[model samples]
Target: MKVQYFAETDTLYIEFQDLKIVETKDLDENTALDLDANGRVCAITVEHASERTDVHRLTVEGIAA
Candidate 1:
């Protein structure tokens, strides 16, 4: 998994899988979900992320090895 914040675009992208995105579904004007061919979510993109999320802070927990 990976998380990236693009300062120039104020966009936040979180990738759960390194899979080819077959389709993009808009959750709203500022949010979108990327799916693979099997229809499983591969990633999520948030526009205007600075306004909607706390981009300065990130925390991860309960990750299993």
Candidate 2:
């Protein structure tokens, strides 16, 4: 998994895998979810990231198998 924050656009993108995104769902105007071909989540994109989320802090636990 990886996360990237775009300071200029105030956007944050969190990717779970490098798979091709087959579908996209909007959780809200500023948040969206991306899914892979099998309908599994592949990534998330948040707009207005600074105001909507704390981009400065991140915690990662044990790796997924």
Q: Name the best candidate (by lDDT).
A: 1
Clashing pairs in 2: none
Q: State the lDDT of candidate 1 residue by residue for 1-65, as single tens digits.
A: 99999999999999999999999999999999999999999999999999999998999999989
Q: Assess candidate 1 and give its lDDT.
A: 0.98
> Which digits, one per residue and each the tens of the lDDT, describe model 2 over residues 1-65?
88999999999999988999999999999999999989999999999998988788888889778
Range of the 10 consecutive residues with the lowest summed lDDT in candidate 2: 52-61
Candidate 1 lowest-lDDT run of ten? 55-64
The regions of model 2 sitting more than 4 angstroms off are: none
Question: How well does each candidate superpose onto the true structure, as a TM-score?
Answer: 0.96, 0.89
The TM-score obtained by model 2 is 0.89
RMSD of each: 0.6, 1.5
Instruction: Give the Å error, residue 24, model 1.
Output: 0.2
